[model samples]
Target: MHTCLAFFIIGFLVSTTNGFYSSSDDVIELDSSNFDRLVMQSSDLWFVEFYAPWCGHCQNLAPEWKRVATALKGSVKIGAVDADTHKSLGQQYGISGFPTIKIFGSNKRSPTNYQGGRTADAIVEQALSQLRTIANERLGKRTGGSSGGSSSSGSGEKDTIELTDSNFDSIVIDSEDMWLVEFMAPWCGHCKNLAPEWARAATELKGKVKLGVVDATVHTQLAQRYGVQGFPTIKFFPSGRKDGQAEEYDGGRTSSDIVAWALDKFQANVPAPDVLEITNQAILDDNCAEKQLCIISFLPNILDCQSACRNEHLTMLKNFAENYKRNRWGWLWVEAFRQQKLEDSVGIGGFGYPAQVAINARKGKYVVLKGAFSQMGISSFLKELSAGRLTSPLVPLNGVAEGKLPTIIDSEPWDGQDGTLDIVEDIDLSDINLDDDDSDKMKKVINYRCPKFFQNNFTLSMQSLSVYARLFARAISSTEAEHILFNGLLRLSSSSVHATQSSNSLAITYPSTAIKHAVHLVTVSSGYSSHDNNEYECITKTKRRNSLIEQKPHPSNVYGDDAFFITKHRLGDFLGVADGVGGWREHGIDPSLFSRSLMDACKSLIDNKLIDLNPLTLKELLSKGYKQLLEDKQCIIGSSTACIVALHNEERILHTANLGDSGFVVIRKNTIVHRSQEQQHYFNSPFQLAIHPTIKDPRLIADSPDLASVTSFDVEENDFIVIATDGLWDNLPDATILEEIKQIKVS
Candidate 1:
């Protein structure tokens, strides 16, 4: 009996997999030339992996591929094509790499190419995900557009349809009624998984909707023509239209969502029920003795009011009637414009053609809605009537008497700082205290918000700056600060002024103080000027300082050429400067690179394992980093320099290295203490070793034996460290920098 059952299963598989392809336990092989025809005819989801036998990755993935194919054998059709043997077929699908998979679904014309890394598990996962989406879509269709619903089906032989780009139009568009087309690629893991679910849906919807598949690889032109940007893009097309030309509806990648959407659209196209129309007087005459709530539609012409006579409008009326039909609340509709008696009964002033509705049987009690009303809008009107606030015309409140206010005891206590107090009581007009701080006084006032202060300050500042700029006006470049101040002021107030009281006040206040302080600083400082005479002198001085600093040489005392040392202590840490590759002379290169590099490198060293008391490891790590920098591409064209130290407790260590120009110093007990001489030749001339063209060479890894000796030192805790790039070192004396650091610390 078991042997007979096995024979029966084999026979069933053989009978099902007939035609141009032959199915085995491992794979379904297709003739290269007839691949398109075979794929186009098959209804099941098809996944074909195009691979080169010689490819190592493909050979390694063969077993896993076979396992996946067997697992999805009954549900999906999996096949492999040897690209080397079928070069033309491979080229058709743009198979430039081996182990490329593509998927073909019922409504798809061509396969989509998978772009991620090729792996057996990745491919299987992708295929399964796609399949689930297609399954959900099919289930949605069978369930009458309702989500999470099931459908009854017959037990019958599974059905299949072959689809391709060439005949996709005939299968999807020109044929029967609704067609759901899935655009997919075999190489795509997503497409592969979608294949099984797509096949199941096709089988379920066999006679209802014509299903087809397109091999995206073999039909590149078709996929591109349809604007198939991504794989597993499924679209629904009504009968008698091409897939792309059909009204496009976005049914997210899920198959169930697509089916639900298709059902909804189809249902919408279904014919609506007929509407019943009656004269305006007929509605008024049939009213009850009690005040009846009526929905009166007014129109200037009978022909123009035909839309109101349609079932769509009647459906809305019927729905309203369902809730109020018992006359417990009373509901009726009248064509007020057509009937003179009804018109006189309701005071509708305009030619309300379309869907105008009014409530209340009495003329003056009605509310005229002069446009089409949606179901929700009509329902809302009915609800308002029930609430005793019928659709009455809006009346201006300008002359309305103010309502009485509660007694003072009933109300909350009046807080002095509350903004509402300003509305209740006017500000004291006689009090003018100019001596008080404006910001502090403003903060104390009622309705005084922070934003208002910012605005007030900004406005006052702009007024002052405008006067200053005109009085001390000079060339365009010199007025940069003024320009910045003006632009900043404009940015604050460009929005609608006074729209927001708090914002308006802020825009005018804070900037005013900032501008005043800036103007005062610029006016008082002798060094700052807008005149050409001072500007030229300033430029010259700056250029001279930069040149002098740029010419200074690296100290030879430091162990590694490009190294930064930071000494941490309780009082404050000492920072060392190390100028690395690239020089100040390079026009486009950043001169501050040395400063930034030293800070970053030292920060990393400190943050990592280097800050501990392991002196040997710290030194070794520092040396290794310097050597690595020399070998780096960036440092090849330039040299490096370093200065390191920190003062805390009663001890300190200061160390720095230099390659070109730049140095550092130490200040202990308020005395001038210089640790290393600036590597230079005489006063202005360059040093022999520094001037040498090979000084910046990457080959110069060892310490320079020709220069002045390298230096290092230990210092007291009270010592101050002054490390500077050439810009600061060359222009200012050591004592000056020490004093500056001390002042900065003190301040």
Candidate 2:
């Protein structure tokens, strides 16, 4: 037995190695015969391109296809087969075009086909979507079986269940299982789209539950019995002893939605079991209290269950539990699979694995540590729990404070309502001394700071300020003075912005004390833009506009200020960035102005004591910001992306508010501890809300436009928060920034 097992392992390794070589830099020419084996053998999802060598479009797409395939080699298996050589297979899949793409699953079932203009990214995305749908469908069926197992008739087959119109009476009504029956039309596009999912679900739940599809065109009686109003209607039959009368469930759902509904409904019918049966219930009962924060770990199996129970995550969980236990908050590890079974006995779909934590059960809030947990990851999780900030029900560890927090105001020159800036009168002539030309000075100022601010510390010595101003101007034009003030303030602010002993600091001096003390200059730049310049645009115009409009604020200026306060207040900090959309020059407004206005608005609010200091005050402030922008049309016209941060001293709270794509990332111990979710949207994005025609008010809701586009999160002391425009994010990954920030010694 041992020898056989060894031989099997060796064979598996050899096969993997062979596959690796075939997928290496040298593209292996594939034909029909090998394609099947390759697709069947891959553990990950596979995308196959069937193309004719002579087709023009196919020839044009060859290089792009190759690049995409090479890029997705490890995550997804990409293969191309010559259609001329695999004429039979191509014909089988109805491949009329020269280039056809299909996604094949691990089970070697019929592949999901794709047509039209094809690119590597497009193909990969499609394959992943299909894979997720397939996986979700399978998981749903498994969930349904254990929760609603009344329809089984001693069938052992995994994918096939015997269900006829005659037996439908006994199976659909009498049986205590949730039955999903699809009335499908053979030629219907919608039905065809749902076929693969239905079949997979049936196969997955074969013995535990029942699933059947009836061709509406062929089974007239079945259609009439269910009052089928559509060509493809699905009816769900709940499990029970209901005198064999079919319970009708409406259809017209995508396969995924259908499966999700079935699982939810089935689970709802069952009751949740007591926690004790799965493990030592007393352990959790003693440590965790209801309506309080508790970190629940998920143990899937025994191999790692023991280690997981005693792992570093557990240590942090224990510490948090001990600290917050007095608040009726605690932490405990629960086996996900075990809970799934227990919940099945009643009805709850368990989520997460290895180690998952529920912050506050009464609040229905939780966070899933999907992978192996570490000490730092656990600590980050605790901090988020303590703050009560989570964008989703699943709270992210080290999340930025959600909503708005009390803004730190140095001083207010005017009340925002009637505040007037005397641009000419306020201009300080002494602050504008220049030994260099305007252009040279602009270059020096704007180019002083690096584009990727989160990764670098901005520390400019007074002597180097002149040279730095020249560099800044050269790096960024059109708004050199603004850039100088912004970067300088950030450098100076960091020095005194200490929230905790481990917080980062920045200090700056503007030539003399009078220049620094008398005037408070705040410079804000727009986050990022999706629009590209047109052909009529001049090179210089494009360069200047793009540089100024697309520039993101230095991380030190945004999150650094928040971090400083988080440390000082003994709470987490909130920070964010916003990007503007539309043509910068064409819009007759600078994107930087929008950012500036927002920062100024926030500062003014803080200065006037208008901002609510408590944790709950965030939602209202965010609502106000959204409303103020919509009402102040002259201030902004084109769309903009925003991220906001809040810090609370008491309860050590940190929260963040966000809209559009400007992102907030949290890092702990050199790893990404949390990331905010982009607001839900379709082909178009919420980021484009500013420019969207129909969304005239552009508020969170029509009645509450002011608060429409906000999402928030919480934070921790050791957490490193990063808020950035898409420009910086496009070029760098979260992991890279985390590594850099980890190297920086916080003083």
Candidate 3:
């Protein structure tokens, strides 16, 4: 048996020597001679993957690495080095694993490890993020700040200040700066919950109102002085008050609520904005050119509406201006027909008078108010605008991007008085209808033009309306048909012609519910791939990917003494591997059972949606999975090392948590760019999670789930991730593994 195993090992080594990829691939091949000249001092960002072609994880990552290189070809420099081939180069960087990725930013000497996912999208995203960081660093240096420090804009200033009894009086009580202080105990659960919210509010309110926190347990004197009796007690100190008692903070505990309450207090001290009339170009430019946003209202002409109505409208504007004083936004009003060009550009025509629009002059974009012109409606609109919920369409602000508003014809402002009507001295009594009833006049007009002009248009409109009504009814029954028809109607309504041939064409060409059902059946029968077949498409791609890389099932999901799981979920795709510690076998424990159970528990959590993807983290999954095993009815006695990688669906981010020797690597263009670091207390004993009924045995080593190393990065399409145990890693050399799979063509 020993001689047969020796022969098998020899055969494996001889097959993997030639490696998996070639120089013709998209990945730029780097070696000892070219590494320094091309990458070390270059201005462009470099993401280099050190890979051994023989590594199964490296082979798996080959396709994704090619994709990443192609996607970031022009923006970033993507390269690969065969660490197995170039022994000297690999040793310089301490490349001990199958694949390792390093990002050479502005500081090339200390290149950071790329911790993102193996997929192309995730890699590209993280590469871009790193690029941005490097750019921001250079920008800071040019603007008189140190590298990685705050720019001249002072964005790096800490928003939250820590206060002790010694400094609390000088910073909050005796100073002129306004402050909101929270006194809390460390042991309190409520305090821990409020900590993040307090920090968020502080960051948002930076450079304005100060937010501070005091540890009530540690700073007893400060807590007692304020009569703090709860886990979290908040107090507010107003500006310009010294030696005065702080007011109790009775507001919602959310970050937004805290921000709103503090902003209200801040705004109380600010003067309300003046509702200036757009009488000339200077008034419009001076008020709006620099502000964050400008709120413009088009009121009826003073002569047309008279004083009472115009003053009332102006009062409403003034009230809103005062309420939003904290924003320091510009407020302006225009009379109807005074700025006809502006009205046309802002889509204010046909919408009628008393129209309102919020414009970002800098962006040259505006959103119109479609709701009522009352206070509540306006408030809701403004709130949506503040929350970035409103979608603003792009508009030309008369060369706003060029630092100028469109030319405004000089006009007189409202003179705070009603105008007298200018009556004509001469009247044409010959055209008068003094004796005619209103019905008789309407009948005359209808008789003259209604039949000839309205006959065709009215008939067409009625026919189209009926068709739409029927389509809408059909849509209620069939969602897909309804969506297509409704979109068509919206397009027709938005176009210049409402009841034209386009509407007829749409009504004629749109598929019926029966036709849609037929098409769906045909699509399913013919295996036509659409976006709706995403799961099928992914599965097909995965199968094809596996077939292309290797002829043999090397790095199988399930291996001897090791187990793994790959699951696709709504949140993202998850890949995990566990290496059953061989030490458990000495005590007659089936090590594989423990590892397999742990992986199964983790997979079940993902399948059942037990792991919420909102702000998804891999550590939470691993910790929870372990907790589940501890609570299991059949307590398995064993230990294993674990590694988990997750790809978030929406963000395309890759999150990873690793414990012990079982690890993963990301390969790009035949090179290993990123690999997980091994965790070990000593030379051979790796960190692991274990379950044992009795804890009195000192011989059994059990590590907490929290001890797992967590990392997150960006990923993209076609990236490869290889997750496996130390068995494969410990036995195979990089070149031997590469040569074994080199013949397998990725279909």
Candidate 4:
């Protein structure tokens, strides 16, 4: 079973295979992404390796395979499939082990097993040998066409016929003799090797079988119409066959072997209702002559006409013969030992009575029906074969790249903050004075709903809301606060008493943790009539609501070289930055989409209160947002090294979720407090979410808990939280990261 199976991986460049390949090696890497255009429809021959990344043998051969590829780059298409990642290709070919190699000829649909030595020189040699054989088959056909005729006389002169385009149809397609025509090319070395043997076999078979050759190089039409890819390509034409019916001859090359093969084919008979039908000119010379596949059956023979089962079976075959006549296909049965050589050629060993197989003489390939020997079963099998459904050498390419690693998020490391920090203060009643005795004083509570698809642009200029107030803007005007709001501020609160109910500037203070207390704005509104202004002076004032700080002390001090880290954020936690996977760079893809998109969605989750700023909520936020991005129509293709820190003030704990190689460390009393663990795959490949089309592992997605490592612990004031991506970790060990942090803390 020579089934060439591999995923053509496009856009891949190796940094090292736990090591690197030599520069002399020139193997094309294949994956699911580009197998069709590069391998299936290819005119060149391809020898592909199905290997696993974790296999020690494959790892060992990595360098040698590269050498093989470099040696045969132009003449033979060579590549490798990572079977570990492409399990479908492996299953289709039944690859139970790694480093399995198969060769695909021009027809791709037909593949041959490669059992030669594993050395680079050996692989190259084998490929070259096959190429020479292919060339010879074509040359023999082009120059031998003029001698097309009958030859019978155990004599050598009258045996072999030189068939040409003009006489091929009359002598081979329309003759009674079983035609064994070899499509050859004169320039091919393999054709030269088989010429003497073929001539001898032609003489020995004489009248029983007509041996002929066609120079495929000169007669391109017949050669192409019959799919002649290699030199010395042999095909057989059976009697009572259609113009396009031909079977390729795949057998031993010796003259005696050729004579024996033709004898069996010439004598091979199925007891059809009519003897003349099997002996017809078309049947004897042209049947299965055009690469068309034919099915033949082997059934039990009855000595007398008294066997009831035999009679019924004969009746069934007769009916089939009648029904399939329009198909121009023949159904014949040969008694046991009558065509033993031919039967063995098609693998008829260990079979019971009434066995049938469809064989393609063009490729010398066949498929046996495993189903019932009935109309429904046989018809179904033929239908599948005709549609090319059963034979899959070429597959279509679906455009969409999926991967788990992300491009680094756009970010900068946090500069240590000093002196004062923004802190949210509970609303104080002592500062406010309400006129209880005023005749027009009004106390009211208004519930507001956030608008769907809030652009979240800093200014509420899209509609009537404040850009900074978010949904709170709906309750007030942007001109009222006039303060630029940070990202993710959804709800807003305002407390105001109108001293005069007429149009007036409403003094508003967009909430900022204590530090931004002085930031305030005022606006005059025409919604209220001037006539009502003097009725009661209105003192309208709005205050800032929630605090979301944005800052990350260090981006790559803890995680891997490609890890992304964000420390203090505007929401309930610290800032965030994602250093996306670098893998997508070779493909011209932005790996940062996963992290940037997810982080952007996280802001919405915070504003909607869809998630809290606690450790668990952060996990939910990260996982849900990331998965949602994965499902987005405008989706992210790769994964990222992500790290986000959430401070659960209520629990007085700092919650951290580290995915890939991004991580953090908490410091107290100028000493290390807590740290995160790094996750990785072979060598430096970190475990992360890859879009489905790009990767097969489900655990790498955010929806899987194991994909992200989480931690929760206590924290105190002035504690330095150092977070970083893999860039810092890969270069600086843990002790180095902590040692530097200790110095910064002490300073």
Best by lDDT: 3
Where is model 1 poorest over a 10-residue stretch in terms of lDDT?
519-528
TM-score of candidate 2 against the unseen true structure: 0.28
Candidates' C-alpha lDDT = 0.42, 0.45, 0.62, 0.50
Weakest 10 consecutive residues, lDDT, candidate 3? 520-529
Identify the superior model by TM-score, candidate 2 or candidate 3.
Answer: 3
Per-residue alpha-carbon lDDT of model 3 for 396-504, expressed as tens digits?
Answer: 6543345555667898877888744332233222332333343333233222212221233433332232222222222132344434433433322211122122222
For TM-score, the strongest prediction is: 3
lDDT against true structure, model 2: 0.45
lDDT tens string, model 2, 1-747?
Answer: 999999999998856532222444433455667765767665667777777655555666677777766777666666777666678877776675556666566445545445324666776575566567666655643322211121222222245343556666665667677677767666675565555556555654554456776666766777777788785576666666555345555422433334444554555454332222125444444444344555555543332223433344445555555544433444445544444432332122322233454544343334554223555555555544444333234533232233211112222211112111111112122343343444354334344332322113234322123222222232233355644443443333322221122111111111111112221111112221111122243234334433543454333322111111111112323333455543333323343334434444444344454434564454455455555667865334445556665545344344566665455566556666666555423112334334222322334221232433444445445555555544334333333344445544443
Ten residues in a row with the worst lDDT in model 4? 540-549
lDDT (tens digit, per residue) of candidate 1 on 133-234? 556556643322111111112231134354676776656666656776666666775565555445555564655664455556667777787777877666
Candidate 2 colliding pairs, count? 55
Runs off by more than 4 Å, candidate 1:
1-574, 580-599, 611-622, 634-637, 646-661, 681-714, 734-747
Root-mean-square deviation of each candidate, in angstroms? 31.3, 25.8, 31.1, 29.0
- Candidate 1 backbone clash number: 73
